[model samples]
Target chain A: MKRRSNSDGKSVKAGRRGTAARKRRPLPTAARKRRHLRTAVRRRTASVGRRERRDQRLARELDDITEQQRATSAVLRLIGGSSGDLQPVFASILASAVRLCDAHTGVINRWDGEALQLIATHNMPPAYVELRKRSPYRPDQHSASGRMLATRAPIHIADLAADKTYLGGNPPTVAAVELAGVRTALAVPMWTEGKLVGSFTVGRLEVRPFTDKQMEIVQDFAAQAVIAVENTRLLTELRQRTDELRRSVGALQRERSNRLMNLEAMAAAISHEVRQPLASIAANCSAALRFLAHDPPNIEEVRAGLNRTVNDSHRASQVFDNIRALFGKADQGRQAVDLNGLARGVLDGLRGEIEDRGIIVELASAPDLPPIIGHRGQLQEVLINLVRNAIEAMDLMTDGRRTLKVRTERSAADKVSVTIEDSGPGIDPSQIKGIFEPFVTTKARGMGLGLALCRMIVERHAGQLSASPAQPRGSIFRVVLPAGRNAATDATG
Target chain B: MNGQPEPQPIVFVIDDDSALREALSSLFRSVGLQAKAFASTSEFLQMNLPEAPTCLVLDVRLPGLSGLDFQSELAKANIDIPIVFMTGHGDIPMTVRAMKAGAVEFLPKPFRDQDMLDAVQAGLDRDRSRRKNASDAAKLKATYDTLTAREQEVMRLVTAGLMNKQIAGKLGVSEITVKVHRGNAMRKMGAKSLAELVRMADALGVRRTMS
Candidate 1:
């Protein structure tokens, strides 16, 4: 309004100058000099007035621009800064809103469907905030802020005492607003893509209405507030997604390494387990060939070599069968397996190994023992692994006393057990408990999975395998399989 | 070529695998190499084997003391036996380590029979040379030990690239006495020349003082 009036005054003065110029030839020199002086005075004042008015307008525009820049940079900083949590960002939004509106108290609300949620506040006394938070805030048209929410516009009240809503209505908000000693307040609606998200509210203690410029400035601050909240929400979500991805990757890495370790163990075990039989096969073959090539052929020795070769080949194949059973043998239906017969078969197959290690075996099985229903191949594997461990244990002894005593008997009326005892150095009492776990090894070249696999096989048969130190020397392994009348079984006994 | 009979050549095999041990013994016997197999090192050490040109086929991964450790132990006990190592699982580093310890061969299992025979033959040859050099030095030392002290001193000087007169001067004896000792020493040592005496002296490790 001031700028338009100033321009109108200049046009009227210009029209008077044009008429004076038209009558200049018909006038005397004195009259002409007076008009020129008067015109000079008028033009001088007009130029000064225009310069002063322009300077005033620029100053006001610069003030408004500076406020907008401050608010914008604050919001941009919140967006770019480290805000893993949005608490600090919320507080900053309220701080800017309160300061920009020149109000003593402020709040930022989040709309969670039918009610307003007060997320953050600045200069709000703890008691006052707690009181307002005691109940849900419904945005109704009865209150000034609610009116703004309904219209998607800013609502400024110069004096709450004169506002109609506060005069006679909704006691809670009016009371809450009054508790803060608020006489005037501004509530600006905040929107994101035309959806009403929340609002920024400011309250003054004095009874003075906010001007149009102050209302506009508060809206700008409200825009900055909405940006900070949305940015914080997106950033938090992204961080959570990244955290979940990293955890899954860590799990995958662990699984892959475990599989690789299991593969390496299988290879080492095959090498340690199968090499002995293969070696004997080669040796026997060479012996047989050499005997046949003799001057007077030693038919007797050659026959014995051929026989041993056959035995060794059979044993080598059995070694592979045992390893295969341990790896991934599909369940070959359980059968009534004679414990004594199985033990004898295993011992017969390992005759070369026992003799090689110079070990003496004492097998004592009670007669008329009931057969247990179990996987024959798997049970043989368990026995082999246990017997092998016993042999290796006795390898430390140089006194030439390597005795393996395997006994089977009815431990109870309903259960039978086989006890394999070694005359090698006894297991340490402390280590007996954990010796059956995977990767628990007593031999340098041994893959510790032998005993662990044995225990797993026994457990799967609804039986128990345990270890104990023998009296004064050696170690004992006992496998107890319940006679099939037990509750966990309905098969052959 | 000497009048004494050459001892028989034998192969000693020490392994914990019984079938392998038995087969190897039969194989060696078929070839007339006189092979003996033992289940363990202790079993081998229990009996006294013949003092013949012999080699040992040792399993590298034995029960108590490993074959490589047994090698160093043999050296410590002053047992001079050449060894050919056999293992079912032999790696490169193990082979290198065995070779470094003077092993004749490191054979991984399932090796060719000829390879075993070759390794045993090489081991036996190595032992033969070692024994020959040792016996020669022993014989020379025994002859040197039988000399009187003065004759021994004169022999030492004579074989040390010194003149007889200088030897006599150092021994504080007359030139004629030095000549008598040198003659007795050469006759007892059976060294027909001064160079032969010098070689015998070197073999016996007989040191003489320089004056």
Candidate 2:
């Protein structure tokens, strides 16, 4: 009975130990559950942070695209507003380039065939403005502006301290740019009509390289600058031509008015000179018939009155015949006329009138003065009218010093000149301006058509007539005729 | 066969231009006629002469009045002067108006000497006969006034182709008294015969309407 009681007690103790181990495993399971909860929270927080970072990146990219588009639109607006005045157009271009590229300075240099003149500048120093006035940079020379102009392309000088073209040159421009703290510069040529007219440049003072966006804005500015330069030159040429045409029209209007006033004055003078002699002839004939009827007939007294009446009637007829020759119907025919012999005939016709007025006429002409081709009667009329006028002009002078000198000379080019000079009161300076206009005369009771008719005859012969004040109180008239094709030339030059 | 003297008619000249007057006076003298020239009509009127036969040579234009006006004035004054008109550059209307005014002749200036002489001669002959007829009428009027109203009636009947007995019965007078009054009237009128007495009454434009 004692061995059965000891085995039951050992079985109870082993069951107790198994119960303790089961309780320890419940504690570890709770700890593992807490660790799994912490891992789930950590994964949720990491996903939220990654989504916020992606949203911020997308926003940044959209802002950069808008900024680039704004710059491109600003450059287009500048080019649209420019009209041909190149100085203003280029200045705006330089300003627009500086603002678009966000650079420190910009300039446009013009090539005037001998020098590079600073046409326009923006944000540049005063020293650079003054140096550009006298600077001459040839196209083949080693210069950033020159390289851009010669190749008609864009040139970039990055890191001015490392550039070889900037070394060992006495150029004031290089030293100026270096002192301005510019580290990068770009130049683009302005071309118009297939020729390089100038160059445009942009610079950065803080040693930064130009981005592609900045280069594109500068290239667009250069293209607009070229167009503006071409328009301005064409506008200047058009204005000059317009000015020349206006001056020519003004001169033609003045000439037309002068011709109209001359014609009216000539008609008034012709009517007044022909009426005086006709009235005296009618009165003398009525008195002669009364004397012949007396008883112790006075025949001798009647005969004397009859003879006087006949002479006055003949004098009136000659005045009308001279007037008819001037304005008769036209019958133009060409013939060869002796110049010297015609001159002598005109002098002889007026010899009596000249001597009665006490005018000493001196005639000097070359013996072999060539025969001229003209109408004989018209030419004689011109010579006689001129000689008669000269003799009459000296009629008021009582002194024996009155003279008329007529001369003919042959020029070296086979032209002929006939000059008539008179020692009368010289023509007034104001009257000489219109001396050839009809009815512009100084003589009392003088019809002023003589000189005008003379000029018309001279012009018809393809010659020229001019007048000037002669030396020492007189006037001179010169007539020039072109040589005939068959006339001999003066060989003894 | 009486030895009585014939009256000479005076010639009157009127002109405006002195030269034309001197010319016309010489022309009139060469024709054996006496002419007195006056510069105007007023000058000729101031020299009033007797009521004799006078011939007037008048210019068409004058300073104060024209020749036609003077001719009408003379007719209104009963002067009985015959006129010959002269002109220089006379138009056709002026010539027609002058002729209608009883002008004897119209002469244009620069005229022939014979034309003036012929015109003046015709004018003088007409004026002399007219003046003689006027004087004879005045004398008959004087004698008729002296013989009373019966003599005028007798003279009128005698020139009317009536017998003395018909004339006495019409005048209510005796035949012997009618013959005596007729003889006195014929003697005053300077008529030599009954035919002359009839011509004198006809020239005076006297008419008797027998009722």
TM value for model 1: 0.63
Please give the DockQ score of every candidate, comma-separated: 0.26, 0.01
**Alpha-carbon runs more than 4 Å astray in model 1:** A1-55, A74-78, A81-279, A324-394, A397-493, B41-50, B63-80, B155-159, B208-211
Error of 1 at A468 (Å): 18
TM-score per model (chain B): 0.93, 0.75
Q: Tens digit of lDDT per residue, candidate 2, span A198-245?
A: 888888886677766567768877877776676667666778888888
**Candidate 2 ranges beyond 4 A from true positions:** A1-154, A159-185, A191-197, A202-234, A251-352, A361-387, A407-419, A442-449, A457-468, A478-493, B1-211
Q: How would the docking of model 1 be graded?
A: acceptable
- Per residue, candidate 1 scores C-alpha lDDT tens digits across A1-493 of 2223122244466578679758635567898789779879977987798689668766766775687678668767876784756667767767766665566878788887688888887777777678668877785777776788888888878787678877765554565456677778888888898888888888888876665666766787788777877777788889999999999999999768645654554564566556766777777778778878777878998899889888878877876775776556525567788889988887897799799878999999889888888788778878877877777778768685789999999889988788889988777778777676433433223222356566666766778899998866998999998765561374433
Give TM per candidate: 0.63, 0.42
Positional deviation of residue B29's Cα in model 2 after best superposition, in angstroms: 24
For model 1, the chain A TM-score is: 0.59
